[model samples]
Target: MDAMAAIKQTFFQECEEQLAELEIGLLAIQDGDVNPETVNAVFRAVHSIKGGAGAFSLDDLVHFAHVFETAMDHLRAGRLAPSHEVLKTMLRAMDVLADFVRAARDGGCVDAERSQTLAKELRALDPDGSGAGSEMDDEEIAFEPVLMDQSMFDDELEAAAAPPVRLFTIRFRPKATLYAKANETALLLREIGLLGEMAIACDASALPLLSELDPEGGYLSWTIELLTTQDEAAIREVFEFVEWDCDLDIESDAASAAPDDIDLAALIQKMQATVEAELSALSPPPTRVDPLAEASRKDADASADPGVIDLAKARQKKSEQAVGEHLGPKPDQGAAGGASQPTIRVDLDRVDRLINLVGELVINQAMLAQRVMEAGLARASGVATGLDELEQLTREIQDSVMAIRAQPVKSVFQRMPRLVREVAAMTGKLVRLVTEGENTEVDKTVIERLADPLTHMIRNAIDHGLESPEARAAAGKPEEGLVHLSALHRSGRIVIEVSDDGAGINRARVKEIAASKGLIAADASLSDEEIDNLIFLPGFSTAPSISDISGRGVGMDVVRRSIQALGGRISITSRPGRGSTFTMSLPLTLAVLDGMVVTVAGQTLVVPLTAIVETLQPKIADVHGFGGGARVIAIREHFTPLIDVGRELDYRGENADPLACVALLVESEGGVRSALLVDAILGQRQVVIKSLEANYRHVPGIAAATILGDGRVALILDVDAVVASSRADSAAFEQSLATAG
Candidate 1:
């Protein structure tokens, strides 16, 4: 990439961070957190993005962001009330602003008409044409110098009589909370320096003796002398982010003396002497590089005087400790110390490559162990012991690599609020979305694929599960519907649920739709759970008529297929007149699997351990054959289908003998228990999964393939698929027999 392209990429990356901050702040405000700092943070996010877009000459982005930022400014200054309707408009504007940014980065275009409409709405939110409104002038809107845009002021003669330069003495004392939030004093000081020529004096008089000091405590403060033509509002904007976390006072010397009349050169000398005396009286501060100066020097505008322009250069010559650099060894560390660990942004491709290499290592280690055992090496032998150690180490390495690919599900959850807003508007229903456990970590690959299915399920909940506002009111429920999304780690897997406090699934309607669509038998007897599941059948729709949101019979079935593709299972539980919840349980990672290797019809197969409820040696007496040559195994109290793996996979034409085979009791996706008959059960092992469909082609009864310890490949059983396929075949066979009879 060219230099300009690389820089542009960095800017876009920063834009993403800014956008996330903006969304978080807005959401917090929506949740009744009307903190001033939150408002400032939200304003700063939009301002920063606009500034970056200006640098790149992204006209559309800058234009949209400026309008959006203007509306937010009204809210920040308390000129605009954060009513639900206003907040709804702002959220939609935020989405459009994000779209503008992505369009700029990708060299595309957003819908101009939509952007223009939102921009007008944003503009209409401001109470006054001038940002200086009445009510918030004292508490929120500080004094800002307004410049005239008339032709007379545009002339050179009038431009020369611009705002006079004033000398300001600013005292900034940041609390420890400032540092805790990762807001550096150095950056704040640098921003101040950018406004004008400034000299800063670090006060170390409050510093305690080394033994008495708290590393994380804020003991130092700074007094700065700035000579600038900017107004007080411009200076305060520099400390906007840390305003609530620090004690900041910006005193303008404008009342006492003008910049030319004030002798800043002499004032700098006095401050320098005071700083030196304090340094001598107290223990000398730690020596460190000046991050502010380094940053200023790297800036393109570095040629202009930014700091200590009038002060003696000799004062800056000393290796003075940076005021931003506190006494702490690690200022950014979290309470538990893990947050202090420095991180770098690495390309995901590198992490994936490492994961693949670790998978190979696991396979190689297993192969070596198998070869050693085959060669008759005793388990107690030195070589065998070393192999065992190697095996453990290999597993450890694999786990560590997988950890690098694990990410919080927040990235996916953050996008749902927008979807909810858009869908709710289209459906003309008031909906409130509540999310919990967003920090649950799962494999990035799974999280990526999770978005689509989750989108479908959430939409289905609103469109099908949730009742209209009128209907809800008539049912004695609140007018607004509630959709809750949550995630958590369960049994070594991640489970996500999208629920709605609506009317729940309409079982009678669902069954009616299924029968009308010819998806199920007209007279079929099904439990409430079975009736609910009919929505998953292809071409089943409960919609009265087709619409954009749903109804071409393609929502839930696609959700099921998408979930199964990620080695996940989804189920639903609904309470009539209460709510409905769609629960999805997915693997934490797809790179490895814990399975019981079994041999069926002379071919080795692997059954996922998560699917197995229990295993037992089947007795011939317990196996009862039904019509169409199907059998069920009676276990404890209830009976489950007995599916022969050999016949299911077409490895043999006839069913395996019940007495000779082992029955592995497993649960399918729909919570149905089935006993899979296999010849013999091999020992369990953790095998590295290889995608069968990617390498070969899609198979009906297999999930993926993995290399066993003995260097042979085994097909990982898709237990749900096998059970489902067998049920279909048996149903077909029974119908054929009935017709013939």
Candidate 2:
């Protein structure tokens, strides 16, 4: 793309970061954080976006951001209370602002009516005009909205046309840091000028000649008189982001100024001085500032000698001191925010390419080790030792590549609150979304694909798992329902859970629905867990009526399929009246696996080591025939169902004798125990995962395939599917035999 387009792309990338910060700060405030920096951070986010959008001529973004920033400015200066109502308005406005920004970047049309409505609400909350006459000399101003065409903003305004104008003097001085931040003084002047009739006065006394001047130095200040119907809060908002970077002073010059002898700026200065001194005593030192009255003066030295300005050095020193705070360090980091943990954004395709190369390196290393052993090298030989070290290095390199793609799940988690809000509004149910462990890291690809399943599952939790308000009340639950989401690393896998505090899944209802849909026999006797899982059967839904939110039986099945496609498994657990939790276990990365290589029906197969509990040679006494062809094995005082892996995979229809085969004690996603019978145990190793579905069509009993050290391809067994299939085939065989007899 062209350079300008590339620069615009970078700005949008920055916008994403700023938007995240904005949301985080707002949530903190909503949760009762009173940190001044929090408000400033939020204000700076919007202000930066506004300034950047002006550069690209994103007028829609600039106009809407202007109104949004004004409301936030009031909160920043303590003019607006951070109450629940006001904060809610700001939050909604923040979302709309985000929309406007995205539309501007993506070349989409924005909903101007929504933007205009939010702008009106934010304007009302500004505290500049809403209150009745008070004791203050200054008055809050409001604009009777003027009619406009539909292009920039909606013509449907909340208030009427502009009635009159109020004149005020605005003092703005630019610091070196202001220009350093890429803020243009002319842009500010032009935007303010658009609001009213304005006269700009420049002070050039601080400027030195070409021989002595530092081009980057702050040597200019301006006094502007603006006659407009806009409120003073709106005027002050133009400098919100750079307020700390420059000296900004605004005052009312009208006769109606607070019936006091002192002007607004003087009174504000005295109150601020006392407040700052007290604050400094208890906290950190104050930021830099300038004497407002001195900066606002139009007269500089009309009688200065033409050769060199008197006290040029003194004026330079004063101007330097009068210059506002420098572009300082981030609050959490050191004084320079530039020293932030250095990071680079790499393309996803590059990361994937690197991972693929690493996987190949692992395979080559394994092949080299195999050749060394075959060549009769001693275990302690130099060649063998080097090969072992090579293996170690390859593994480390693979891990490092995986780490490059590991990202916190917070990106997906951050979108949940909005989802819960939308669902709650649609269902007319009050839901408080409580999330934890959002910082748990997972593969970037996994996190991206996991969003849809989690979204649908969360919806299912609230709609199907949670009881209605009246029902919850009767069941001794809170009037307001809660949907909880959490993620954590467990046993080298990322386990995410979506749970609710409302009524649990109704097993009887679920079973009836499954039966009506012909998913199960009408009179079938099923366990509670089985009934709970029935909801995942395709076209199975218990909603009484079809509606926009959920009724038509689509979500759960898709959720299950998507999770499985990610090499993950999902299960559900429910307590009658308490709640229900849907847990999904996904591999941290799909590129490699720790697997146990074993021989099954004369073929090498890999079983996920994470699924295995133990291996044993089952004694004849411990094996007992159950129904039809099914059997159970006793291990550690527990009788677990046993499935012959060879028979399940259709390698041989007949069951292998227990004496000739080994039993692998394994657990499924639902914690169901089973003994998988295979021929002989091979060895455990890290196998680079190769997708069988991508190369060949998917195999039902196999998950994926991997290459052995000796260049043999082994199918990775889907232990869950094998264990589940055995029960179904056995039940069907028993039913058929009974019918034939």
Candidate 3:
């Protein structure tokens, strides 16, 4: 990659980060709780991106950035107050800027229509329409300060007419490890001798005695006075490698001798010109070239003159290539120049592919272990030891690969604040979102899929769940309603819970909605937990108004379906006027699951272990009908619903004596436990989850299919769906029986 390309890559990465910060800041502002520091942070992110773009001569980026930064500066300095209208416009501007940066990086021209619209919006923020003269732009926009003026140059030229012998005083301190690798300070002195006439002085005051010295350690320091035609930078370059590890100070003779004869300004300008020429020559060519060809050429030349290869240039090239491959072709130079933003864009497909490969590796390793066991390696003397080592190594590799795909849930959670703020603003409520476990790691796929569901839950919590600020204060709660979003890994599943401290779900209101929607019978008996879950039924919202924020009656059910599709379940718990909590438990990865294999009518089925509560043998007497076709199993005093696996799956065979059947007790929505009677337990194993949607339509009670260690496919059961189907069937069976009687 060339210098321009490398700089462009960094610009996009920084822009992305700035956009994220801008999003968070806007959300906070919308919530009516703007923090000055957060505003400043967002301003700085934009400023940094603009600066980087300027360095690469991306004018388009610089132009819009200048305007956006001006508006942000006004807000930061308290000249302009944050309001709903302001935030909305700023968000739209942020989106436009993101597109501009992307277009620039891809070598495509910016959309003139969109750019003008965004520029108009920014200009509107300044009533005068000038949109200029921000102090920050004047002081902070320039990379560095200009050192000398033209008058200083003219005076120096007149003084330089009389040639003068310039003397210099130099002080140098070498780091402790400077002479440890068979190279001595003598080599450095020899190199310096070639540059000028020098007087060397050694400082040995800090060197310890022979007994106290470490054989491999260096202990020496030196200083020098040189009379040379060489410039100051040349003298400084002699200690460049050890600059950070040592201290060096150089004093020009003008300070100690006749100032008129020395003419320091003339010498400095000459040195600057020479440095600029050298830098321009060393810089990469202005024209673009094929990166692959460049890489090949560099690799071939690496052997001929190893010292000549610039590591910085090589690394820069690699980073640019990586970015291009990940984010597509570079944006047009003009489009890139206008926005000072930094962002690192990565392709989602690459992340998905990486996860898929890791999943396959895990399955193959499991198969290998199974083969070793079948070969009787565990019973053999030395074979068992080797097999154990192999298993350990395989497991280590699996863990390392999985770790690469795990990303903090923060990227998803950070969007919640904005959501809460928007919902609260629309509903005329005050809500503060408190988030925990933002750093918890989950599969990138899980994180992406989780964003929508989490947004819905948060919106619901703010719009319908939380009471108005006045109502909250009257009820003894804080004036600012609190909505809590938390996520954590429990029993191999990531559990995300969204809870609020305001008005909870009204059971009567939910029941009324269910009845009006014809979802439940009029006099149906149900538990409190069951009533709370009715909100997840399709089109079962109790909101009285239809607004752009949330209440069109089409979110909760979708959230549930999305969670279930990812091999997860969603549940709710609420207390009257005490708030509600919606908890969603999702699989660690969609590609694989830790499952327990079981046999039903000679067919193997995989049940995710996370849903299994216990296993037991229930006698015929414990299984009794509960009026409908459904049966209940009495375990101690509590009666749990029972779903016959054979009947549910339409399996036909000689019925196993009911008394001898083994029950796999599983928990479903709202703590509804069910005993699934299978033929036999086939033990537990990790299996790769293969999507049914890839080849076949989704089966009602099956989440996915996986290949077992024995190489046979087993369908993974969706316990939540099974329970749901059983209840629906029971209700239908009861209605049919009543009609017949």
- 1-741 in candidate 1: lDDT tens per residue? 599998898889989889888888888898899899999899989998998888899987987888788898899999999888888898999999889888888768899888877877777787886533422322455678998767755677675666578888899998877776667777788889898878787765675443334445576688988888888899998886678779999898636344577677787777677666654465334674445433433341334233333233322322233223442234454233322444677888999899989988988988898899889999999999999899889888888888899999998999898899989999999999999998899999999999999999889988888899999999999999999999998657788999999988888888887888788888776778779888889888888889989979888999999998887778889999899989998989999978899999999999989889999998877899977789999999788899998999999998778899899999775567899999999788889989898899889899899998778889999887899799888867866776678
Candidate 3 residue-pair clash tally: 32
User: TM-score per candidate, in order?
Assistant: 0.82, 0.73, 0.64
Q: How far off is residue 401 in model 1, in Å?
A: 1.0
Candidate maximizing TM-score: 1
What tens-digit string does per-residue lDDT give for candidate 3 at 208-250?
3322333333344555656666678877766644554456788
Q: What does candidate 2's lDDT look like per residue over 1-741, in tens digits?
A: 599988998899999889888988988998899999999999989989999999899987887787788788899999989998898788788888878878888778878787777777777785778522221212357769887666544443423343346667788888777766667777787788788666555455454332233445567776676667788888877776678778988987555322233354554454345433432333211463233323423122223222222333434544454443542222454322232244677878999999999988888887888888789989999998888898889888888889999999998988777677678878878777888998899999899999899999888888877777888788888878988899998767899999998678878888888888899989776677778889898999889999877889998999999988878889988898888999999989989988998998899999999899899998989999987878999887888998999988989979999899989998887678889999999888889998898899878889899988899999999988898798778767866776678
Compare candidates 2 and 3 on lDDT and give the better one.
2
Model 3's alpha-carbon lDDT is 0.72
RMSD of each: 7.6, 11.3, 13.9
| Ordered list by TM-score, greatest first | 1, 2, 3
- Candidate 3 residue 319 C-alpha distance from true site, Å: 23
Which pairs of residues have clashing backbones in candidate 2? Answer: 128-140, 137-258, 329-335, 329-336, 329-337
Which candidate number would show the highest lDDT if scored against the true structure? 1
Report the candidate with higher TM-score, 2 versus 3.
2
Per-model clash counts, in order, read 0, 5, 32
Considering lDDT, which of the candidate structures 1 and 3 is the better prediction for this target? Answer: 1
